[model samples]
Target: MASRSDAEAAANAATGRPRVAVFRPDDERLESAVSLLSDLGVEPVPDPMLAVEPTGETPRENADYVVLTSKTGAELAAEAGWEPGASTVCAIGPATSASMEAVGYAVDLVPDEYTSSGLVETLESEADLDGASVEVARSDHGSPVLLDGLSAAGADVHETVLYRLVRPPESGDAVDLAASGDLDAACFTSSLTVEHFFEAATERGTTDAVAVGLDRAVVGAIGEPTRETLTAFGIDADVVASEATFDALARETVAAVDR
Candidate 1:
């Protein structure tokens, strides 16, 4: 079977499809980006620069509540047979909430902004976390925003590293397209994707070439964190989604490239 990029290229050859580099891990998660990009008439090229490895750890047994910042965290936590233990589950966004719900876990709250700060603000205003035991399920290299915020809010925060991100064996075709200037745009969903993309480019000795390609193409980020990560790599995102969702990112990427 042809690869996703090859299949999309052949299908959209006559219409001149916009090529998009999707830097997500290889899993069902990748299909979400593929479906959204295809719907927008963009050719999404898989650039699985990062792979997720589960840590096989269960959640804390005696927590009053649980917090998850990403869909992956929610999925892994459910898979690990984590008992919520009367904890009111809180997620960062609709996607994360939906993931938890699919695995028979109920999400009690989701922030308005779909971010750490947003979750913190909501908890501060709507919930009484004072003296509550909150368990945070996240990746090994996860951000400290949620942890610090919960601690400050008087919640006894316990952390469980449910998974880890590792660089993929190959960078796929993204670097090639970026170097040749064929990639029309790129969507970065996480800070890790930006870091791994640059790492992959550097490994292939195409950092400078990839930088030029990124400059030529319209770059779209899912949120502020991803945009800041891109900026750290000297590639400013041309468009950032108002909402931190793949659906929003797809629409913003198309709009950015159209302009």
Candidate 2:
């Protein structure tokens, strides 16, 4: 009995294209990822692992610094008409900066590295955190490194949950494909996505099988945090994108698959 993954693998092999699993949210981000993979000449398995749930919350108006970690957060803040007011606006990466700019917001600072720790380092060097009010606006699953580091630097930090990242109900197909050894590579953009991938695999009773398959596949993580999460699951990332962006992740993963 040929499994669905077996059939899909045969079709992919016939087409001479590598199958890459992408676990972005089901929005323009996912659509853009799929298009990017197609342009990179790979067959993309568009399994949307994360779904955004807006909390209808905004950042504090009185903070001295406002930090946004993701493009979605920037868009949500703009949608809520949340202005920076007196606060200096900081973005974690170029994409978030671009998103803020798209909404006519001025991005005052962006880290050289695009991680939470990177942002913290940038802020510590660039801003006077002693007794400063900093508001971090992002998703509920945001890393504590930013808040903890800022507080340690003597900044009074507050977090506003702009949205919640929940695993979508229909996100396990890629897990099944990976378990069946149909995937050639996977691009994990966040730590949460890596965690949710295994959650799906565990639910399907294929966690070990999926892990084995992934061990044989070229895996790409968007940043150190995501790579650490994969390591916790006993999976070594074959490629960690030099840039912590999906575009870089997808390009690097596809290039690895080609090699």
Candidate 3:
């Protein structure tokens, strides 16, 4: 395994093209960012700012409801062997529900608000959690929001770290896109993506067209976490949906740009 300190150096050396910035660096997200950029004819210089890696550990025993919030959770559950019937499955939104369903698990409920608050509300409103055992599947880099909420609502709540999100190596061509000023708008799906965008943006020293493009060009995030990332960068998010689904994200983008 390459050392963390030098990973960026190697990645930069390998980066032959000047990329536009994208937040969060991981295999699945990276692919999605590129696909969107290509579809838009933006041809982004691909660089991720955050790296979320799965731990692959199963949830605590007696897990009766498995909670999936991000694609990371879904991907981890895909290989972590948490069976559906073992617990009533809950997804934060439809895209997650679809991912879970594609993996053969039937989702029990999805929130209407599509944020962490929304998930809690959905569970409280629809689920008879008077004595249910629940486990939230997620990366290490999360808050205690879900667990606290579920526990407060009389559900036996357990939390498991299915992955870890770390900052991607910085200081390199990924820098060129944000710094050298040779690119257009970027895209993000998570707050991590925003982290990545700012890291490169700060390095570039000017937020002008690049930042504007991200804000103006059709910002599409999968859910609240992703949208918050865009907002944190001091760029106004043009599209904010009530749900957390790629369908919503994609459809919102097409509408934002078309209008």
Candidate 4:
């Protein structure tokens, strides 16, 4: 009898080309997904399951600090024409910090790790959050980790929900490929994207199919948060990027498939 790994190896040898599904919203990261998979000599399947719409609300005045967790939030908030004034700006990652800087806002701090928990740890140790007013800009679907953490540290946290993430009419081609067991791997960038992907699979009556497909496919997660989300759905990530960046995730995905 052939072992599971042996079967997978035989399948890969038969196909000659690995098919990797890019599971995320259509945004700046899409280009990286396509290009990275191509560079690894894999077939790239673009599966955009979510869309972000900016909210029109402006940032509040008298904030002591401004917190941005994602580049999308930073971009949308900047487009809304809100000034950060003399408030210290904090970004979750370098990408978000760059976005904030591009809009003429000086970033005062960035977490060593690009995560909500990392942000909380950095702020708790470095800044005096007691009774300070902190403004957070992000999507409605964003996790409450940052807000809850800041609030627990005695900061009066205000939220400027800059965008709402909405599901598309249908799961893209990648979901179908995943359901049919035709995909060699799939990369999930965010927890929301992982949630929406399964929801779409259920709606299309491909839940079982996807479950079976995932057993044979290399699952790649962008970070610890996304990997945790995948685990919640009974799927284990075979590869998790060291950094929470698209390029890192793509490289990890290719490495996972190659292994």
Candidate 5:
């Protein structure tokens, strides 16, 4: 008469093996997850779901500040000959700060909370942004939250699109793996991965899409935004990892499933 929770806990405890679903798109994280999961007696399934594309648009006009939300976005900027020399720079997290620093840009600030909301909160409290022209280096989607917040705070904010989130050519393979139930589950590190991969599946067929999406592979959302995307797709995630990072996803995967 064990409840579902008790059954899952017992299953995990008795087996002492974690069947983990790694969703990072075959990058270094995939290797790391595979290594860590193997060391921990967990099976790591590396299935990449999204691709990041950069739009090599030069800055239309210079600004006093530039903010980068993703390490990839900052790297894209560096690739596009965009380097912050005198202007102050803001990054969303430690990974992003390292990326910017690698390109020789000194990160003026990184929010403690590591979200757009937290970034805005930090600007409101710590920055003297009055009359400062700010530029945001970003991908194709999301609101103008950073710009809007800076503008509302009396800063002149400008936006520069640096990248786009697209489906990788091999995303279909990942989808097929999920449909076949070999994936067990997939982790959504970002909303873009959810949008592009699901759109790719729907393009193939809705029934197959649902088969791939159903509880077949427990969905692991990394944060609130990713969770929102999964819910929008009519899939209630089995777990939303503690933080918006891959390490959190990997750890949560190990905790939730049994081998």
Candidate 6:
């Protein structure tokens, strides 16, 4: 049986479209990514690395501020009928803010940099966090930077695990493609995605080969944290998108392949 990558490679060979790996969760995100890549004139290998498992938890309502990190978190909070009440609603980025807004939650704050550190810095500069109660609702794999930074600023921080991002069991197709040097580029949207990609490669006993193959292909990371993860794995990213959005990451990655 021919692999998906083999069929994609064969099709792309004639169209001259670059084969770019996208590791978004298997949902509307993956569909959107595939559409975007197709519009960008690339053959997107839709290999979903992350699967969202909702924790059936919501942010505490009594906090001074409520922080939501991802669109998924915001949607889940909305579905859980969690209300901000007197708390200031903060989103980690534009997408999160939009999600909150769509759910009728007023977005009180969004960091200019759209990262954990950036949100911490923004909150410190804008709000009075001294002895304030802050509730952070996000994924289980969230960075500790936000909590640490908020605590250091004298805020009592509490975290609610809204979801767990686990790697899908059958997510190593892109790893096989990468190991065979068949991919033209890859867009890594998060640090976990990078870690999961390597985990898949390692599981297939193709870690070294995948690394070597990646050396020949363009690699793009969504932000500094993701790039740092790739660096930890000894994988040098050819492009680090200026913005942390998937749109930015995909565009930058596809452009790198064109170059």
Q: Could you say which candidate leads in lDDT?
A: 2
In model 3, state the lDDT of residue 230.
69
What do the candidate models score in CA lDDT, each in turn? 0.84, 0.91, 0.63, 0.82, 0.69, 0.90
Q: What TM-score quantifies how close candidate 6 is to the native fold?
A: 0.96
Number of the top-ranking candidate, with TM-score as the measure: 6
The TM-scores of all predictions, comma-separated, are 0.92, 0.94, 0.70, 0.90, 0.80, 0.96
RMSD values, in order shown? 2.1, 2.9, 6.0, 6.1, 7.3, 2.0
Q: Whole-model lDDT for model 2 versus the true structure?
A: 0.91
If both were scored by TM-score, which would come out higher, candidate 2 or candidate 3? 2
Query: Per-residue alpha-carbon lDDT of model 5 for 52-122, expressed as tens digits?
Result: 66678744446777788876787777777776767777888787888888877789999887777778889
* Order of the predicted models by lDDT, top scorer first: 2, 6, 1, 4, 5, 3
TM-score for model 5? 0.80
Off by over 4 Å in 2: 1-13
Q: What TM-score does candidate 2 get on C-alpha atoms?
A: 0.94
Query: How many Å off is the CA of 144 in candidate 2?
Result: 0.9
Query: Model 1 misses residue 164 by how many Å?
Result: 0.4
Worst 10 residues of 2 by lDDT: 1-10
- CA lDDT, candidate 5, residue 74: 70
**Candidate 4 local Cα displacement, residue 253, angstroms:** 1.7
Give the runs in model 5 whose Cα sits over 4 Å from its true position: 1-19, 33-40, 59-62, 206-213
User: Which residue pairs in candidate 2 have backbone atoms (N, alpha carbon, C) closer than 3 angstroms, thus clashing?
Assistant: none
TM-score of 4: 0.90
Candidate 1, lDDT over the whole model: 0.84
> Model 1, range 152-233, lDDT digits (tens) per residue?
9998999988889987776647777898888899989889888888887887889999999999999999999889999999
